[model samples]
Target: MTSDTTRTEPVASPTDRLRRLVARTEVVLWDFDGPICRLFSGHPAPGVAGGLVDWLETRGLRGLLTEAERHTADPQVVLRAVDRAGLGRGVAAELEERLTQEELRATATAMPTAWADPLIRTWTALGVRLAVASNNSPRVIGAYLAGRGLADCFGPHIYGRDAALHRLKPDPYHLHRALNALTAAPAAALLIGDSPVDHEAARRAGVTFLGYARNARKARLLADAGARDVIGSLEPLLRVVRERGPGSAPRPQQHLPHH
Candidate 1:
């Protein structure tokens, strides 16, 4: 006789895979600049970088940079160049301090990324340990989080730019520090970031990387960088949170005889 039993299993979709990833994640390492907020939105980053260059020029150190370095608006790149120029500890310290002060000044007008706040709160409510790993200064990050009332959510787990600009993302230094602080396995952590640098660092640290692309071009770039998954919106993640509730694992699949 033919069997007349049937079974149902969860059909995995993109969102399903994302949900599964989150369900297995013990910690979430967030990259501050894009994933969290546009920390340099209101205050133009190029202006800050230009200011750094001008400071060096004031000290008669303008010849220290190549024309390209002086023209670049990226502060981190400029800082790295300064370090590679072997400007000594005093110069590095001063530049880093100046950058930190500019970041702090920008924090007051930093623009929040859409859906990031809710997603963070949802993740926190689900008992996920959260940390910030970024190239920005920790003091600036702490200040921004405090302003957003998210300081207690992450506590002292915020990791950011250290003494050496060369040790930033794509080097896995900050990611390692965050992992150590959480005492969480790399396999059980998820990193959400916007740049390829973040992707590279996560790969080196053996953590699952989720690319948060704000635009189609950025999403394409992340995919080109070999990011397994890229998300342009957090709405799907929010939906998953509502469906699964908090601290719940994915339902196990079941099988039965076919008719």
Candidate 2:
């Protein structure tokens, strides 16, 4: 049975392995960026002038100028765009300060096409434990849950930066902490993420990884990261968890009647 749980790739033989593996995972740990709540915390959204401001080091118009040079290729036009955009109150400098590590993650965008309540509902009914384990700051993570009415699903038990400073994902520390808190064994916990970092963390922690490849590029990325099973959307994930609620011991084979 343990052998059957290792190969998670949806290939013919390994798919069987993945099935066993997923069946063994009873607890599910989810992330934000490409999985649940996508608020563009780390990088700026596309088409925004000086959008990648959070990554710049200089200050005031200096930072905006830097973002222009780094991203737009044409610094002159980039600066002009920034001026026209009027950036917001203290938006440019405060965004660049990188002061708290939390402020840098300052956006309010939800994962498009995601249905939090329905997904959480099914998992809850199945007795499966769920958690959010992203590196997103508490404020941003909270904002996401609040907007979606998902705060109740996680309560104060999620593992974002607000919960801990565990050097972020791909480290397994957050996952370890979550497992300890939930009182579930590592073998029984599953992690769903869009990045390879999440895959490495699961491998190190001996937890199952279900990669949600919301896009074509990410789908390939997750596959390359040793994802056991990859899906283009959350609905398939919901199906996996519901159809295969962690592997349980199969019923003992019946003995033939003595003839």
Whole-model lDDT values for every prediction = 0.86, 0.59
> What are the clash counts of all predictions, listed in order?
0, 5
What TM-score, computed on C-alpha atoms, does each candidate reach? 0.87, 0.64
| Number of the top-ranking candidate, with lDDT as the measure | 1
> Per-residue lDDT of 1-259 in model 2, one digit per residue for the tens?
3555566655565445455655665677887656775555344444333443424334445454543355662212343334445775354234423322332343443444475467776666666667777655555666666777777777676776432223456778777777777767666777888888889888887777878776898888888776767767676545555675433422222222211
Residue 48, candidate 2: alpha-carbon lDDT: 36
| Model 2: pairs clashing at backbone N, Cα or C within 3 Å | 5-21, 8-228, 23-246, 23-247, 24-247
lDDT of 2 at 244: 50
For model 2, give the 10-residue run with minimal summed lDDT: 250-259
C-alpha lDDT (0 to 100) for residue 16 of candidate 1: 75
Model 2: residue 142 alpha-carbon error in angstroms: 2.1
